[model samples]
Target: MTLGLPDHLVEPILSRALARASHWFALTCLAGALLSALSLGLTYEAGLLWMAVLSVLAMAALLVTLSLRPTVVLTIAYLLVGTGGTYLYTTDLLGLPDVFPASNMFLAALPKLALIMVGGAGSGALTGVLWSTAGFVLAETVTVIAAAEAEVTYLPDGFTISACLFLVAVLLLAGTARRPHRAAQSAIHRAVHADQSRLLRQDLDLRALDLNQDTTLNELIALSRARAGPLTENLSGSIRAALHRLRGTDWLTDADAHRVSHSPGADAWLTSEVYLAIERCRDRGLVVDVIGDRSALGRLDPVVDRELGLAVQQCLINVILHAGIVSAEVDIGGDGGIFSVMVMDAGRGFTESETGADRLGLRQAVRRRIKRLGGSVTVLTRPDAGTSVLLSVPAAAPAAAPDGQGTR
Candidate 1:
C-alpha cells in the first residue's frame, strides 16, 4: 500500500514543508528576542540590563548562523557554544548574585530561544527532537535553580506556555523534515509497480505479434517454398531454434545479436573501451560528440570495461536507428564510487509504453549488461522530447590478481 502522488506533486509538498520550517524557526527567534527585551524593560536594574544585552547578542549570533545554513557539525557546535556562553554570562563566571531581579527570567528564555533557532538544523526529525529535549531540560533546570534562590516562581511569567509552544513547534518542524523521505519511498514503490504493469502490457500486445512475424510466419513461408520432400536436418534444426526463441524471453537476453563494432580512426585516441564503443558507432555513420571526463573510463577493469562498452554501444545504436536524429552526445563523469556516462540525443523520443517485446535492444543489451556489471541504467524520454540514457557503474573496478587474472 502506498500514496500515488506524481513526482512533481511530491517535490513541491516537501519543499514547501522545509521552507515553512525555516520560516517558523526565524519567527520563533524574533519572538523570543522581543520577549527578552520586554523582560529587560520591566526590570531596569543594571546587572539584569547587562545580562539582557548579552542575551540579545547571543540571539544575533544564532540568527547569523541560521542565515549561513550551517551543516550538522557546525550547527551542533554553534548551539553548544551559544548555550555555554549564555550560562557563563548569567552567572558572571559563577560570581554574580541570583537576586539580580530579572536574572531567572532572562536565563530561562535564552536557552529555549537558542534551541528553537536550531531545532531544524540536522538531516532528520528524531535528531532534532533529541536536541530540543536536551536543550529544554538544561534550560528548565537552570531557570528553576535561579528562580528558587530569588524567592520567585519561574512558571508564572508565561514561561510554561512559551516552553510548551516551543516544544510543539520543534516537533512540527521535525515532522516536516521527515515527510519527504517517507513520500520518496512510496514514490519508488509506485514506480516499480508501474514498470511491472508496462512490462505486462508489452508482453500482451507484442509477444504474439513478434512470434508471428519473425518466427512462426517465417517458418511457414520457408516450408511453403520447399519441395514436397522430407525436411533437411539443418532446416529442421533452424525451425527448432526459431521455435525455442519464440517460446522463451531470449530476446531480452541475447546480446550477441545486438553487438556493434567500429573501426578506430588512425588519428583517434583509444583512451578506453567506451572510446572503442564510440569508434564502432562512428563507423556506422552515427555522429557522436564526446564530452566531460573521458579519463575515468580508462581506469576500469577489463570485464567492467567490456560490459560498459556493450551498454554504451547499444545506446548509441538506438539513437542512430530510432531517435530520428543523426547526431548524439556522450558525457562522462565520476561521483563518489560511481562512474556515470550519459548518452543523450535531441530527437523524437518515445515513452516507456512503446518498448514493445520486439524492442529487446534496450532491455537485453543496455540494461541487462549494466545490471550484470552491478550497475544501473535510467532512461528519460517522451514524445517529442530528447532521450538521455544514464549509465552508472562502480568507480573502483573489482579486485583481481596482479597478473590481470581473476582471484577466484
Candidate 2:
C-alpha cells in the first residue's frame, strides 16, 4: 500500500508532487494568456503588452523560487506577486470589466487559479486550505476594486467560488482521514518498540550467563594452582573480586560505573553495541585501552553495530586465550565514509597458514561478519610480533536535526 516506500516519505513525496503540478498549472495559464493576447491582436497597446510580459516573467521567477525554497514567507511573497501579475495581465487582455463576459471569462479566472495554487504549495491539507482561502479573499478583493475603478457592476465568478468550496471539502476529508492513519502508525511503533525490548532482554541474559561462567571457571583455576601455604596477595585479590562479581546484582563494570558517575548521558555509550565487548574483556581482567572517537560507533546501523561488536568480542577473547599478554588497544575512527576499529595486542602472533580450520574465531566470527556487512578486515601479524586486526565498514551519515542543524 505504501508503494515500497517508508511511511515518513509519503507526505513529503505527496507535497512535492502537488507543488510540481501547481507550478506546471500556473505556467500553463501564463502561456495561455500570452497566446490569447497575441490571437486577439492586443499588440496595439504596446505599453500594456510589455507590462504583461514583465509580469509573466516575474511570476515565473517567483514560482520557481517558491518551488526551490518553500518557506512560509516565500509562499506569501509568491501569492502576493502572482496575484498582482494576474490582475495586470487580465486588465491588459480584457481592457475593461465590461469585456469580461465577451472573452469567455478566462482572463478574469486567471487570478482565481493563481490563488488556488497557494493551497497546493502548503505543507499539509489544513494548512493548504487556510493559505488558499487567504489567497482567494485577496484575489476577490483586488477584482472588486478593479471593477469599481472602471465604474462597472462586479459579480463573483461562480467557477472560482465553486472551486474554493470544493478545495475546502477535499482538505477537510483528508484531515479526517489523517487521524486514523496517525493512530495506526502509533500502534506500529509501539509493536516495534516491544519487539526491540524483548531482543535486548535476551541479549542481556546471554551476556550475564557468559560472564558468570567465565568468572567462576577462572577463579576455580586460580584456587587449584594455590600452594598449601596462605594464598598470595594477587590470589586473594582475584578471589575476592570474583566473589564480588558473582554476588553483585548490577551488570555494570568498573569503567562503566565511573562513566555513569561523571556523565548522565554515559548510559547511551555504556549500553552501545561495541561497549558490551569491551565490558566483557574488562571483566575477564584484560586492560582494554580504547582510543579515538567512541561516538562514531553509534552512527552505524543496528545490525552492523551488533556484528562488529561480536567480532571485537571474539578478537579480545583470542587475546585472552592465546596471546601471552593481558592488554590490548581498540582504536575507533571514521574516514572517507568508512568506520574503522583496529584491535591490537602486543602478544605472540601466529602465521595465517598455521591457523587450523577448527579455529573459527578469526575466519567465521570476525572476518566473515564484517564481510557480510560490506566491510573488510585486515590482519597484520608475524611470529613473535604483535597482532593488529582492523575492521572497517561503511559509516552512515549523521542525521540532521529538525531545525536544520547538526545533531550530536
Candidate 3:
C-alpha cells in the first residue's frame, strides 16, 4: 500500500487529512452519479449488471479511504479502483449485455474522481485538488483514446458537462480541507491574548503587594508604636510623606505604566532608588549628605535597583552603627556606561582583612551581591581614618533606561 512503509505504520496527519477529504469525495461522487444517471437515463436494456458491479466496487473503495485504517490500505484501495475502472472500460472482463458504449466515458472518469475525492483527503485539500485535477485530465484523455479505438461517439456537450461537474467536486473538497486550519488559527490567537491579559493582572497584584510591604504597612506599624504626648516632628513628616506617595503614582511599577520619553531626565529624582535609600537612612536619624549626579540612579532595572539598593543600605548601616559617626556622605554619579555610589564617613575604619567570620555582612551582603551583578565593590580605609565603600554596576543607556523598579 505504502511505498515507504515501515514495520508498523502510523501517520496521524495523513489519516485526519484523508478523513476530511473523503467527505468531499463522497459528496462529489454522489453528485457525479446523480448527474450521470439523469443525463443518460438509467437504461437497463433488460438487466442492471455493469452499473451494479462498478457501484459496489467504487463504493467499497470510498468506504476504505474514509476509514481510520492504515494509509497503505487507502493507497491500495485507490490503486485497485483506478486500474479496475480503466480495465472495465477497455476489456470484456466484466462484460454485460446492458453495456452502452457512451457510458464507458463515465466509467473512465469515475475511478479517477473517486481516488482524488476519497484517498486524496488523507493527504490534504491541496493534494486532493492536485491529484483530482490530474485524475480528471487522465480520465478525459484515456476516454477519448478508448472511445476512438472502439468507434464510440460521445456527444461533445455531454463530455464537457461531465468534466465540469467533477471539477466542482474538486473545489468543494479543497474548501473543506482549509476549514479546520482557519478555525484552529482563530482559537490559538484567542488563547494567547487571554493568557497575556491574565498575566498582566497578576503582575499588577504583585506590584500592589510589594508597595504595601515597602511603604504603607511599614509606616502604619511605626505610627502604631508612637508613645505619649503630641506626635513627633519626624513621625509626622513620615506620615505625610507616606500619604503623598500613596496618593501619587509612586506605588505603580513600570509594568503597570506606559513610558513615553518626552525629555531626558524628566522624572529622575522621583525614580531614583539611590535617593530613596538616602531618605530611608535619614529617617533612621543618620545625617546623609548626598553629593554628585543623582540622575544616574534613575534608569536602573528593578532587579539591579534592588540589588544595588540593598548593598548600599548594608554599607550605610555599617557606617551608622560602627563608624562612631551619625553623619555620612553618599556620592552618586556615572559615566555613560557605569553607575557608582560611595558611602563615606570620617570614623574609626578597619582593615579590609578584618571583615572575617564576625563581620560576614560586609563581606557577603555588600561585596558578594555587587560581584554577582558583574560589578565590583572597593573598600578604602585604615584604622582611625575615614572609610569609603564604593559600589558600581553596569548602566543601560539613557534612552533605553528602565522607567521604574517593579517587585523582584
Against the true structure, whose lDDT is highest?
A: 2
**Over the full model, what C-alpha lDDT does candidate 1 score relative to the true structure?**
0.63
- Summarize candidate 3's per-residue lDDT along 241-284 as a digit string, tens digits: 88887766655656334343233454775466666667566545
lDDT of 3: 0.60
Q: Give TM per candidate.
A: 0.37, 0.43, 0.33
lDDT of 2 by residue, 1-408 (tens): 121322333454566676677667766766766566554445364456566667767777887788787889988887888778766765565564244543226566664566666676787777878887887887777677656654545777776787678766765564444444544543554455567778977876787888778898899987898788987999999989988977764576565445546453245456678888887666555779999888777677766677789899999988877676778999988887899999999998989789998889999888877776777899999978989999998886333232323222
> Where does candidate 1 stray beyond 4 Å?
1-43, 85-111, 148-151, 154-408
Worst 10 residues of 1 by lDDT: 259-268
Best of the two (1, 3) by TM-score: 1
TM-score of 1: 0.37
The candidates, ranked best first by lDDT, are 2, 1, 3
Q: In model 1, state the lDDT of residue 383.
A: 82
Better of 1 and 2 by lDDT: 2
lDDT of each: 0.63, 0.72, 0.60
